[model samples]
Structures are given as C-alpha cells and as structure tokens.
Target: MNTPTFRNWQSVQSEVLRRIHAREWPPGELIPNEADLAIEFGCARSTVNRALRSLAESGLLDRRRKAGTRVAAQPVAKATIDIAVIRHEVEEHGAKYGYQLITRRIAVPPVSVSGTMKTRAQDKLLHVRALHLADDAAYAVEDRWINTAIVPDAAAEPFDVLSANEWLIEHAPYTHGDISFSAVQADQGDAEVLGVAPLSALFAIDRVTWDNAAAVTKVRLLFLPGYKLRTQL
Candidate 1:
C-alpha cells in the first residue's frame, strides 16, 4: 500500500473525510497535526490546514486553540439557507415581482420582540410592514422591527421604493442569525395583507440577526398558502 500525494486543499480534504468515514479517525480521536499530515500527504502544511478548517466549519472536526484537532464526538449537519430579495424570489418563480409598502413608523416593539432581541422595552424600533407580490397576487407579508441603535440608517430611509427586507440585506451586514419556520393561522392583519381569509394556514418564517453583541433586526414573514421552502445541507 502507498500513501497518496495530494496537490490541492480539496483533494486533501477528501482523503481526510474518507478516513473519518472509515473510522480510521474515530469519533473523539485526535488527528495528526498539520505538519504530520503535510508530510504524509506530500502536500504543504497550508493545504492540510485548509482541509481541516473546512471540516471544522462543517462540524465534522473540532479545532480548538492549543488543543489539537479531533473528529467531532457528535457531528451535526446544518442546512444552508439564503436570504434573497423578495423581488428575486418572485422573479425566479416566473412571475413579475411587485412591492407595496404598507406602513413604516417608529414604535416600541412588543415585549416578545424586545425580549428576544435583547433590546430595552422602552427602546423604539423602526417597524416596517410590506407586501410582496408575485405577478399581481400577494406572495408574502413582511412584518419587521429594525433596531436603530444598531442600524441607525434604517430610521431615515423611505422604504416605499425598496423594501426594508432588501435594503437591510444590502446595507446592514450581520455576524450571525437564526431562522425558524412554521405553519401559522392568519389573523385580521395577515388576512388583509395577503388577501386570504382569516385563520387561513400560511407558511411563516421568523428570523433574528445580530452584529456581534448588538441585535440588528427581527422579522416575521407570512407567506401565502401553499408556499414551499427549499434548502440544502
């Protein structure tokens, strides 16, 4: 048997992945350092580092400072979701996109939002309500609260032309976010915005984002009936 020589980071990563899958590097087993891996694979140490870092990000490997890399004791695969402009979403569905700004104002967020975003109850947030349309029909209703303390520019911008959903995505960048999906029954507000009967079942997405320690925004999007979400792991 001969050790294989790898020329690129991807090939090195592949071999390491194979070894892990074969249990040669069992769960919780510390793997060789980059220097050793580079020598064995006939590749540069940077290549090995790149490969291991990639694995670490994907939850297949655990890398700690001053603690050598090891296979994750309990690996988890995360699904990747993209936050796209509502316009793009409708256009991709082969329909002409339209946007209507329902309301925009500065108001104190509900306790539910303030508690989740960790903002002060007395703090005012920019509340934006908008309707996204596919062709001429309603697609989704966006209810959002923007933390002006973190994203001050959002307070001044008139969202009548460009939706706050698209505006924040372009201007305010965040470090990390969380999203959840569910089926929710429409209330009077949702019924009016989506043009659906009250209590109609709709797909909903609730999202919150932060920039380091400061919360940036919290949004709830209620999509029309029969909306299907797709993601990749």
Candidate 2:
C-alpha cells in the first residue's frame, strides 16, 4: 500500500514559501483563502491556519477579515535583523541582476489554504513561479499564490514580461505584514531550480503583507547556499 503524504505546518510553510520565492504570489498580491491551502496541502484546515499564524507572527504574511491574505511589498524586518531587498542585495554584492519567469496558472487551492484565507476551498487562485539570478548565477527561487477575488487585475497582468514582484510592489496597496528567516535543505525541485544538489543547505525568507485587516499576499524566497544575512544583537 502507498503511504499517505504526511502534512504538517512546517510542510505547509515550506510549500507556501516556495511559491512566494517563485513569485507565484507577488509582493502585495492577494493569496488564496485558507481553505484552499488546506485542501492543497492535504492537511487539516486548522493545521494550515496554525502555519499561517506562525508566518504572520514571524512577519512573513498579512491577514485580515474580508480582505483575505496578501504578500508584503516591504516585508517587515525582524527586530534582530535588517531586511534587504533582493535586487538591492544583488547589486550591493556587485553582481548583475537577472530574473526569469517559469510558470503561471490558476487552480483551486487546498482546503488548508482556503481555511487560512478564510474562504471556501473551491475557489481558484493565481499561482506563479520564477527565478532570481545574480551575475547569471541562480540567486533565489520564488513561488507564490494570489487571490483573484481581491485583485482581479492580477489575472490580466503579464508576469512573463515583468515580474510579479515588481508589478505587485507598484500596483497593490498594503498597510502592514510580517517577515521571517530560516534554513532548509534543497529538495529535488529546489535543486533543479537553483542548480544545486539535493539536500544542499539553503536560506529561506517567508513574508506576508496586508492592507489594513485585509490580506494582500504571501510569499517565500529561497536563496542559494552561502548567502549571508546580518543583524545587530
């Protein structure tokens, strides 16, 4: 018999982060409702909710009633660390910046996602993936999800020409959100995207944004190995 995939808050967080870094859900973009995420993750809605809540607490996501969730244009900096913009980070390192779009789609989110977004599971959401490069070398991968109900214009935006990251930062409006950081082993998909060996260590940043109580978007950014972040103690 085949074993069922074990779903948990950590897995959910990781998946969500993947999408964010891919720009499937761009900064300031609305994300799928929680119920959709829960269904997609094959986990309890409560579990998805818990994961989102943790991201929010970590300054990675913005959540609100009626408005739903969204990605933050400027992810809040952790008190212990200063948040750096991806493009700026690359330029500061004296590397030429590059970006590539990989995929875009609209699909029904898992129940867990819907539960977190406080929407029905049957709702469809916009998904996007992309890559960030520095001096022609893979710098990071982005995966994201967007809520059409809140940002209908997102459906027409051309992600192939301009990154969702730049688009949302210019178009979507938001008031508050959160950010977080961590380390994770590259999985098969991440390995392929980043051109690294599977199980390679990588840095991760998860963020969520909001326009008042309404959520704007959620995303995760995965950096290539050796990337360093500094903060004051």
- For all predicted structures, in order, the TM-scores are 0.74, 0.62
lDDT of 1 by residue, 117-175 (tens): 99999999999999999989999999999999899888889999899989998889799
Which candidate has the top score in lDDT?
Answer: 1
For model 1, state the Cα shift of residue 36 in Å. 6.5
Off by over 4 Å in 2: 1-80
- Model 2, residue 133: distance off in Å is 0.3
Residue pairs in steric clash, candidate 1? none
lDDT to native, each model = 0.92, 0.79
Report the Cα lDDT for residue 93, model 1.
77
Tell me the lDDT of model 2 at 174: 78
Among the numbered candidates, top TM-score falls to 1
